[model samples]
Each structure stands twice: as structure tokens, then as C-alpha cells.
Target: MLSLQQLSKQYKNSELALDNVSFDVPSGQVIGLIGPSGAGKSTLIRCINRLIEPTHGAIYLDDVELTQLSTSKLRKQRRRIGMIFQEYALVERLSVMENVLSGTLGYVSFWQSFFRKFPEPLLQKAFGYLERVGLLEHANKRADQLSGGQKQRVGIARALAQEPSLLLIDEPTASLDPKTSRQIMRLIKEICKERNLPAIINIHDVVLAQTYVDRIIGLKAGKIVFDGSPSALNASVLTTIYGKEEWNTTPACEEEVSIAPVPNFQTKLELAI
Candidate 1:
């Protein structure tokens, strides 16, 4: 559903953040991007959405060349790409429902958005997304009132509300507790599978990625070092991606704990429109 062809990025007067990173994402597949800090995980995600302009190369979503699009055309194209941030980027003063509805801003007129006057059908769809993310009851609550996990849930709902064909998630669980992180990961995985939406998740936790993602892509110093199934990510590969370090020892807490199963709300979500 998505393809990156020789995608490269370099900041002003800085070294290349991404180096000829190329990959393809099939429909309904979840790809986990893992690397150490400054490995260009965030850069790749931003480049896809044109949040940061790529220095060179091309990004294609469903065969549409994003790099060649005009500003207006890019805006239209972006409506099909949903993004989840490391920090829940919700409007603090807005209600959860309001925040979720903001996902449709690209589709609405300036005045309609200014007045918070979304179509009834879109409002209903937003509610359905909230329910899918287990946040229906908290729809009216202010975004600031929610906990970290709850805020992330709202973020997920908002992304889904876009009815996106692709999802770009940047450190979806970075701020949450371990258990909550797992739950969020599971939720993201399930939703992607059920909706048949391909996703690229920028995650720091390799263990968590192995548990949930369909495939893994390891980056080191802005270049892809390993690209394969989670089962193929052995100590050797991790050492290569993270640098020479003793990975044989597992943390005591990690060994004893397992990710908790999230509630099955798949049956309740009407993903097909």
C-alpha cells in the first residue's frame, strides 16, 4: 500500500537523518521500525507525511508520488495517512470527541472547523472510533483530564477517525507504563489487522515489537541494517542495530512480566464504510 524509493533526508547544515531507506508495506501489515536514539526512526515517519521535507528521493502511497504533489494536492493526500505521535497531541481544552473530530479537519471547511460544526455522520463515525479504542464513555471529558494511557487511546481514536489507508505511528507507547504500553501495542496491532490498514510503527522497545509486529526493520545511523521477521531478530542482529552490547541477560522485571490482553472490541467497531 505504501512504498519508499531511495528516501533520504538531511537537515540544514546537519548530517543526513535518513540514508536511502526504501521499503514496501502491504495491506494490513504492521511493520515495526527499531533503532537506538538518533537512528532516524522519527525522520522516516515525518518524511512520509512531509512533516519534514525529504532532501531527496520519493515516497509513494498507493502508487501516488507524494513528493511531486502541489501543496493543495498534498493536503488532500494526507487525509488518507493517519499519524500517531510519541506524545498524545490532543487539544488540552477540547473534549475528547472534539479532538477525535479534528482528524476530519482536512475534509471540512475553515468556518465549519472554526465553529466545531462537523457533519452528523462524521460525528457518529468519530464516536465509533472512540468505542473501538475503548474511549466512548470518556468522549465528553476534556483531553487534559485523561491519564497517559487514556490520552493515547484518544490519539488512536483520532487517527482512526480519518479512515486512513496507512498509519504512521511514532513511539506510540513511549510515555506509558510497560503494561499500558503493551495494551496500546496490542490495540494498534488488532485495529490495523481488522481495518486492513498498513502501518509503520517507530518503536524503541524491540521486545514489544517482536511480540506484536508482523515484521521488523532495524536501523543504525540512518541506514537500514536488518529487515526480516521478528523471529529472525536474534542477539547478533540486535547487537548490530544497537551496537556492541551484552543482550544475553534479560532484566528480571521483563522476564517475570507479560503483556496483558486487551479487551476484544473488534466486533463493535464498524470499520468498513
Candidate 2:
């Protein structure tokens, strides 16, 4: 389980990207962090991973206190937390398999990683994840050679290769088409269920989040204004989070509906998109 007690992030200029935010994510649960741009969703996740430091409060992952760990200890603990990015942060020049193997860099010696000499078990595990993500056939292909969806799949494979206990996904489907987005969402849901992995997905697509995630957390102006199941979301709530507007989550196409992401809801406090 992951717990945040009064977590907050205030930038150098006195801007509060995250304002006393606090929440808990349990095992096997997928929490969709949704809000209009600048609601501090991205800041929250990055703070959890310590990519951005919180100005106050403590973060607990299971029995360990994440915010209290030293830099060296944090590096080791970070191995258990996987991050999936909006841009599909794969090495453009590396093959898919090699990109996936990069997830294990922390576990290997400097020389082993430098030489790309991972153990047989780690290699097999990477292959399994590649197959799990339906990217085994593209293992030898360069990350730059794949489509957006395929590149995201390789990112998924890489995160899985870490054997992470928790996943922090930032806009996983933002770059893909509607159909590919659904496929990716389904894949994420299935993987979470299969592994009992607790995940916090920073998503802009409320419809997709409603379709796949277990719970929804809505933020506004760096504060969590709503936390409930998807069924509980209505226009009134949407107004509360995104402010008053004509909100439509429905898709024009009956076959594959691709709703646009909520207007870029970032506070411009570095990157809380």
C-alpha cells in the first residue's frame, strides 16, 4: 500500500503546485488522477517518486517512509516504483529489447550494465514482458521505428521489466489514436489485475479513466475536490473540477470513441500537466 500524509509541493516563486494533497493507493487498485490543467496531478506523481521534492509531509510505501530515505537509499527503493511517461521515453537508438533491459540498470553492477551483460533470468523476464505487451515481434526493432502505440507498449514492457510494486503512469494514451488508447488502457488494467500492482495513472481522458480505472480522483487548483467511483461523476462534478463549461464525454463514432483530453490542465508550475 502507498500512503501520502499531507503532501504538498510549493515552487520557488511561492506557487503551490500541490496544496496539502493526501491520498492512499492500495494493492491491485488503479487510481485515475484527473483534473483540469494545473491541478497538480503531474506534480503529485512526480513528488511521490521524488523526481520533485515535496515541501512538506511524508510519503509511505508499505513499511518504509519514502520522504525520509537518503539519496542512495531512495535510488534503491525507486526500483520498486515504475514510471510510464506521456512521450514514451525510450532511447531512440536502442532496440526494443535493450530498452526494456534498461529497467534493470539499477540491479546490475556498473560493469555488467556497461557491458550489457544481464543475467539469463533477467533476459528471460524481459522477453516475457515483451510478449506480455505484445511487442516480442518488434524486440529487434529500434524504438524510433515503431508507431506511437507500439512505442508506448515498449515503454510498458520496460516498466514491467523492473518488477515494480507500484506504477506511476503519466498520460499513457495521450499520443495514440482512440482505438490504440483503448487497447493500451485495457492492457494496463489487465496487467494491474494480474500482478496485483497498485497504480496511480495521471490521465486526462475522463471517459477512458471511467472505463478502465478502479477509482477517480479529481483535482482543481492544486486541491483534491472529488474522490469517487466513475459512476459518481456527473456534469455538476465536472464543473467543480474543470470549472463551468459545456462538458461532453461522449464519442461521435459508435465504433471507437476518442474523446479529447480535458483542456491542458496544468498550473505551469514546472510540469503538473
Candidate 3:
């Protein structure tokens, strides 16, 4: 439902963050974006959301050229695209309910939102989303009072409150511990399947991405190196994407060794043709 054509981004000094990157995300599909640090994975997402302006190229969402839309129009379009940040991005002073309802601010009238006067149905929806994220009991708690994982759950609930058609998650588990990270990832995967919301998540953990997403897109130096089903992901592709011959040299994390082989791991690499 989203397409990027020759999408390129260059800073004023002409440092390219993305280079002629192009891809399409089909509706109801969960696509994982993976790459090494500075591979432009984060930059790609920011460009898609127009959180950072693209230096050149076009982004089309269901036939509408996002790069060409007026500011006001773009703001409206943004409501259909929900973003979840790695940092949780919760307003520390706000109640969980307020934070969840903040997702609807793009739709609520400026004055009404400023006054914290969301519609009753919207409030009900917020409560429902809290329950979906298993945070219903924390509805009245201040966001600052919650743990990192709980805060991220609130973040997810906030995004759901938007009732978005597409979800953009940036390293959703980066800050949480291993167990909590897995829990959050599982919840996101389940929600995407149940809601049928097309999603694009930028992640550093290849194992998590492979386990959770329908498709994987590997990036390198601001360009796409691989894009296919998770089962198709192999060591060679990862080596090229990360630009590391010794990419798989590290010993397995206790966690990594337990489950299925991570395609990027040394043992898995040695086994691959």
C-alpha cells in the first residue's frame, strides 16, 4: 500500500543518508527492515514519514504522492500512519489514558485536544487499546511511573488508539530487556495479524525480525541489498549488508543459541553454502 521510488536523501553537506532506495509494502503485510548501524534503516523510515525531508524522489501511499502534499494535507495523511519510537516517547507527566488518547489529536479539534476534551467514543477506544496492550490497570498511572516495557506497551496502545492503516515501528524493543523485548515483539506481530495493518519496522536484531515479520528487507550504505521472505534470508546476504566478513564471528548469546539459528550467526554461516 506504500511505494518508494528512487528515494534519496542528502544532507546539506551532501552526505547521503539514503541512495536511490526503492521498495513497495503491500497492504496487510508486516515488513522488517534490517541493516548494520548507519545503513540508513532509520533514515529510510524517517523519509517515508516525512519526519525528515527527502532530498530527492517520490513516496506514494495508495497512489498519493506523499512528497508533494501540502503541509496541512500531509498532517492529515500522517494520521493514517502511526509511528512508535524506540524511546517510548511518552509524555512523562501525562496519565496513561491521556497518552493513549493523544494518538487521536490529529483528528480531534485543536481546541478540544488542547482542553483534553476527547469524544466519549474515543475515550472508550483508548480504554480498549489499553486492555489490548495489557495495560488497562495502569490507565490512571502517570507515564513516568511505568517501567520501560510497560511504557512501550503504553506507546503501542497509543498508536493503536490512532486506528491507523499502517504502523511504523522503529526499534520497538531496543530499550527493553530480552524477555520484555520478545513479549513486545510478539504483541506487535499478533496485533498486525489481527488488525491486518500493513507495518514497516526498522530493527537491528535479525533474529527478532526473522521470527516476527512476513518479509525482510536488508539495507547497506543507504541502499537495499536484499528483500524477500524471512526463510530466504541467508548468511551471504547478511555479510554483504553488514560489510563484514567476520560478521558472524561472535559467540552466540545464550538467548540466540537456544532458539532456531539466527541467519547472521557464525555457526549458521558456517553451515550455509
Models sorted by TM-score, best on top: 1, 3, 2
| Pairs clashing within candidate 1 | none
- In the range 93-202, model 1's lDDT, one tens digit per residue, is 99999999999999899999899889899998999999999889999999999999999999999898888999999999888887898899999999999999999999
Give candidate 1's TM-score. Answer: 0.92
1-273, model 3: which lDDT tens digit per residue?
899999999988857889999888888899999888888888888888799999899998887899998999999889888899999999999999999999999989989998998999999999999999999999999999999999999999988988888899999988888789889998998999899888999887777778789999988888889999987776677777776565446465644565644554424232111
Q: What TM-score does each of the candidates earn? A: 0.92, 0.91, 0.92
lDDT of 2: 0.87
Backbone clash numbers for all candidates listed: 0, 6, 0
TM-score of 3: 0.92
lDDT score for residue 128 of model 1: 93
Candidate 2 lDDT, 1-273, residue by residue in tens: 999999988999868888888889999999999998778889999999899999999999988899989999999989999999999999999999999999998799999988989999999999999999998999999999999999999999989989899999999998888789889999999999999999999888777788789899998888999998877777778788887765553334522433423233311111123
Candidate 1 Cα deviation (angstroms), residue 248 = 0.7
**Local distance difference test scores for all models:** 0.87, 0.87, 0.86
- lDDT value, residue 270 of candidate 2: 13
Kindly provide the TM-score of model 2 when superposed on the true structure, using C-alpha atoms: 0.91
What are the root-mean-square deviations of the candidates from the true structure over C-alphas?
Answer: 6.9, 5.1, 3.3
The residue ranges of model 1 lying beyond 4 angstroms of the native Cα positions read 251-273
